[model samples]
Target chain A: MATIKDVAKLAGVSASTASRALHDSNMISEATKERVRKAMAELDYSPNYAAQNLVNRKTNTVGIVLPVRENQDSLGNNPFFMQIIQGISSICSENDYMVSLATGRSNEELQKNVQTLIRSGNIDKLIFLYSKKGDPIFDYVKQQKVSCVVVGQAYDALTDHIQYVDNNNFQAGYDAAVFLGQKGYHNIVYAYTDLEELVQAERYEGYQSYIKQQGLRDHHLGLSRVDNRANLEKLQSFLAKNPEIEAFIACDDIQAIRLQRLFKEADIANNRYALLGFNNSLITEIANPSLTSVDIFPQELGEEAANLLLKKILQESQTLIIPHQIIERESTASIK
Target chain B: MATIKDVAKLAGVSASTASRALHDSNMISEATKERVRKAMAELDYSPNYAAQNLVNRKTNTVGIVLPVRENQDSLGNNPFFMQIIQGISSICSENDYMVSLATGRSNEELQKNVQTLIRSGNIDKLIFLYSKKGDPIFDYVKQQKVSCVVVGQAYDALTDHIQYVDNNNFQAGYDAAVFLGQKGYHNIVYAYTDLEELVQAERYEGYQSYIKQQGLRDHHLGLSRVDNRANLEKLQSFLAKNPEIEAFIACDDIQAIRLQRLFKEADIANNRYALLGFNNSLITEIANPSLTSVDIFPQELGEEAANLLLKKILQESQTLIIPHQIIERESTASIK
Candidate 1:
């Protein structure tokens, strides 16, 4: 809470001299600078960054823009976002950059808050948690020439301008099918939610390519738009018709966990089907029998996004693809 | 991105007049105010709040101070913290206040960041997620006379000035024991972590009180400082010594989930021991038999904290205790 006057008085210098010394102006002599530094340190003075930002136009902070969730009740409750924040915060801490989160119950509100944050010059860069088409915030950031990076896969056409960090989701999907096929599972289903999500689409495409190349069949079960109970019933009927299905490639770990719970409720034997999930999140480990999942390395994705955004802020440009690995666990392991 | 000049030109007034109109100064006539409002709306001009804050000294933002974690890798990865944030964000959104997180890898770094944040005047209120003893940030906030509300139980003497929101943890603990005792599980264990944590301490006190009143023996297990494997081995050994123990009251859901996993790995039959956990978090649902946990209503806790902080900021003071409930699930259901 020490002011410039206090530092000046403590150092036996004028307020202007103290200010100059703090700002490292050439007008302040080395002795005066040393005295002012000692005085400020003694007083525990913290330079007001907001006041400095008015002249520098930089806040040394990154603004994290969260995607407007479909489930408003679960806002900030998603483990995926929590992991991304952990990655982002770790990197930001290392770089001495502060982080501020921008969220809203709706997209319009989210966009408005983002605009306010940007216009107020509270952040030097923006790291978006998702990259969806026709997003106003994305369009605004692009039009305003702001330094930004998206954590999800970007559209093919937009990738040239919008840099992003993501995993090879398509290859991950293909590998899931190949892994199951090698495990002696012939009929495999690609089960997922949020069919409109680009990651899900790409993963599904990978599943399609793999099934075709291997002379296998493809069955898509969409659960994104439906409620959990409805999705469970739909899954049950599908399994009844296609009892030959020996394995399923789920889009993410939560869905895979849900599928496992449903299987248990339906009295389906554990060895009857193998389930492969993505994200290798904690849920996979907590799920009974555990879960075999593709470790998309979400934290790495977040770290990559932060690194890319920092690069963009420094006038550098780069796109990054975080690697993914399959973690074979009880869900896909041979039952003893 | 629109400027005051643009609004002035569109409203047929000078920039000064436009600014006054925007500020709603009494010197500006109603007619001019109406014109400026229309121009601002037409151009989608947002007044710079940061500049206004320099005068009004309010940021309409809350600074959420997290406990400095020893586990640097899992920063912001705690699901319990995530749920609290969900609650905080929901209430903040409802009140049109922004949420910013302040955390660091070390206590010193955390204090520095908090000081900078406070000195920069970027937040009007601070909400601490924990109230452990000898917390430098807590001491600083108290010394600075800053508006704050703790989310956990504070020491009895400090509660006079520090408004807090918490459950009756003693009752919650007592209720856990009584719930198990009522179900014919006479010999029960109170399992917890971080006895230093006030919540855990209060819960343990409640458990002790219950055991004394019921004339049943009390056994305590501490796992906070130990690694999971070590804790599991210790638990296995404890169970070996006390095979008559019929139930466990884990301090939280994550611990409960871990206990369930350990029991399964150790080949302990589920029906042999009942388990009860706190927080009714997602892990409970994902656990094999589905855990029965105490629902402390984390979202409501967050809402209450925000409400209390707002009231304190507005010159009101009141301590609040949010209600807790027991959620019965397969983990505590009658043995089949």
Candidate 2:
């Protein structure tokens, strides 16, 4: 609530000198700078965002779009998105940038709301969450030329080349297959969500290559998602018909959790089958046998994505790729 | 991006009429309102919060002070908070309000924040998530005479005074006990979060009253939380100490999921040691032994709380104590 003038008066310095010291510009003496800072802190002075933004022509604020559903990712259940956002927020906060969340479930509605913010010239940059194929939002964002970075893989061709942060998903999939094969868990079933997603395609290829290398090729691949209970039930029916399936590789942790729950209902527990999942979500920790899944470092992802967006607004750089790691839990075990 | 004048010219109405229509004031004719709305839609006119707020002397926005880590309640895991927020947001968007989130973990900091917001006159009213025992946030709110509605329970001192929404905590605990008892499960274990909280205290009291009334004297209460993994380990130790415990009632779904994981590790599936959890969160659907828990109708809570806050802000009288219900899931019984 305190103004710059309040600090200046308290520090016995002119308002201009106080502001210069606060901005850390104009080469103020160390003693003067410290005095100004002490006065500012005592008076609870905060620099004005609105006024400062006009001179820089950038707000250092990143606008983020998420699904309106609170359970879109389940807050604690999947810390991937939340953690990424946290990372982005931390980076921005450190650089004095603010993050605002804008949400709508439908793509059309989401686009309109984002356009409102875009046209308002409120945010200098944007970080998008969706990676759905043929994303209309991405297309619109490209047209607007708002410095942008995507958390997911790029969906389509656009005016501006979008920088993104993603794991080496194909390599991860390939490695999962190799690990399962090394454990002597043959007759593996690679069940996943939409196979069209680039991440899924890479993982499936990895699974296939591993099977081909093992000379135990005639295995099954079940495709379904935990997000859709009906599709999961359908996938369960398919799995029931295929008795050759022993080990499983799920595209994501949520899918693995649902599959495990279904398997349990069919009287299958750990030791009967090995299960490996991705995203290393909270599901991995809570699921019976504690699922072993890949940790994509969501919080780091968010932080990186946010920083990338900030750099774009600052006219710095546009590209970055964070690393990924695997966490071992009870779900997958050496074939015993 | 279009102004009121642009909308007015397109709608063939005066600028004053357009403003009145946008504000939803009683002055505008129905035909005029329809025409202005059509123009606004065509022009992509997103309403201005600050300008309208200046004229109306109201922010229309209500602040929801949340704990820094909000994954505690079912609202954290379930899309419940999102659903509630969406419901409130729908009304706010239609009515033109900007919702701001503030952190409210420590009482001193919370008091400082509430005071700052009030002194700055940023928001129209406050909607508190949990009205714990004489929380400092409430104390400051009362001191400021700021309009507020407590989403959870209010103590006896503020019961007839402050507007609040109360969940049937006592009923939920009583029903849970009765349900377990009827299913031929006695010598139950009442596992709860720290009952220093009013809501928790009420729930515990309800459970105790039920046991006393039914003459079922073989139950013990224990403090078990999932905020940390060590507490979960402590819960495992508690279960080991009292091997005779047939069923455990968890206060929160996260706690139940943690309990479920511990049970799995200890090889105690639903058949032998049944567990009934509270706050029918998303954990129930995905947790290994889906939880049977209470539903506090979070969306309704948000709506009712927002409506009450608005009423108070407008100097309109409103009352509280909305109802709650129980939702049964697999954690309870697959009994004949």
Candidate 3:
């Protein structure tokens, strides 16, 4: 007889995700759930829902802990977190689970809200919509021994106990550089929103590693603030310094589109440079040449995070790595 | 010895919103709440919390009902609703109220979810993020006599009962046309996403009214679908058919950005056409010439909607018209 472990192995996911998928939990994505179902069918495995329900005693509600940024209004400014929330909502809707946002303007307020949510039995599991160093929330969750998942690259030192879902950003960055190279761009400028963001740093390292391997020249650019003034000045300086730069690999699509606009204003011919970005957002499609970008599939990441957290709640814990893809558009279609 | 109704009038909100604001309810925005408090103080009135609490029987939580669209993934695709959500979140956070989202892929599912949310006591009041005629959800809410507020213009028939918050889109559209005319663009194209959207229809009417009054030629264009193929084809046809068209008054910023891209690809010179849009989104900031657009103040609308809903919940209701502002940029700076 094929056991649940065999099915999990076939699906290539954590035993927890596989178990949640089999139970049609709201935390798993349709794609992951379909894969688990296919694996179960092949292995002839059937889960006992009645017995699992008796053991579960689940609240069917998940708490989303949004990050507290310096600006305090980051949620309204960045579409990244909103996209993740949509993804989480999709999966939760399917599984008949409710996702409530628990956020505050400051760390103290956020900690208080989280503690209250957990103590009051409002949420069965918690999903941190961000991963960063010195996040006090993580320590509190750990101390409380609460079931939780972080939706970004996990902290290296705490990887053993913390469950997380993240894209292989390093590989994604390396692949972006390789794509640019294949299009005959030798001098590449790496543009980033912030060096402190975990994904940006990882992607930047991967980009550096790729350029070094290919013996290509590197031009680093930073958009350290959302104010746009610093970013615009940096762009002008970079262009003045590196007139021979053939392509730009922005950390994300928003900045890439902004760069495209700046390039136009600075009288840089569109045909002279290829712009590649991450997070193939709507902005990419609306760009003049339609920007080429890496698709990190935030929806899938949200699904995986929710799934991992649910599994942890059920005493089935595991980390998951979501995959990414590169989308080719007119921005990188032709060499100058 | 002033009444709550007087405070509502002074605050330029409905009676329910005024009451909620005075009570420090979660459904009122900070701005409106402050205004209501000021109005109360000026009127030399102090509310009795015990009596109001007994009369209100408030749960202090509000439900946000998102529209079901033909494209079920509209929530992820459009930043419009996301902005409104952020606005609602800000106000709800200030008032110490929990905001819960109720959405479904179809009308039936949406109605069912709304009913369940209300019946189960997960939400105390409701706010609809979008409004159009013949929304079954509206009918259901009315039948159940559920307290609610719509974020856009209320339907003519339902105006008596339904409270709402909307911009003066008509005057805004007329102003946009007049602005383009001042820039020496006589032949103007009035563009829209879909005629069915309430805002689109109102803005289009405003555009028509402006052209007719000025005795200038008016060209009508529609992006019937967001798929881009039909939109691109329509753009090509519009350009070829009306070579005399000098300026475009797009219904919203997203469509305006898309039109700019389409024009660029179709071999239209950047300076040949004056482009103006509504809702000064980030896309406006990143456009080649930085798009000229109307600032609808979505955050304020969200705040107003929450305020109205709380008022409706407390049986103190009235319609509110939030104002709009025009922001000029390089896109319509001068005619070539």
- TM-scores of the candidates are 0.83, 0.81, 0.78
The residue pairs in collision within model 1 are none
* Cα misplacement distance, residue A236 of candidate 3 (Å): 5.2
Candidate 3, TM-score vs. the true structure? 0.78
Error of 2 at B162 (Å): 6.1
Q: Mark the regions of model 3 whose C-alpha exceeds 4 Å error after superposition.
A: A1-58, A69-73, A156-160, A223-240, A311-318, A334-336, B1-58, B69-73, B156-160, B224-237, B311-317, B334-336
lDDT scores of the candidates, listed in order: 0.78, 0.66, 0.75
Clashes of each: 0, 8, 3
lDDT of 1 by residue, B1-336 (tens): 789999999999999999999878999999999999999989999877677777687776787887777763354445667667666766776665667777776888788767766777777688888877777778888877478888987664444487887789999999988888788788889888788777888888888999999898989887743365687689889988987888899988877876776786677775568999998766566565778999888767787788877654443435577889999988887533
- Rate residue B111 of model 1 by lDDT: 84
The Cα error of candidate 2 at residue A243, in Å, is 5.2
Q: Rank the candidates by DockQ, best first.
A: 1, 2, 3
Query: Which residue pairs clash in candidate 2?
Result: A83-A298, A83-A299, A84-A298, A84-A299, A84-A302, A87-A303, A88-A302, A88-A303
Global Cα lDDT for candidate 2: 0.66
Q: For model 1 chain B, where is the 10-residue window of minimal lDDT?
A: B310-319
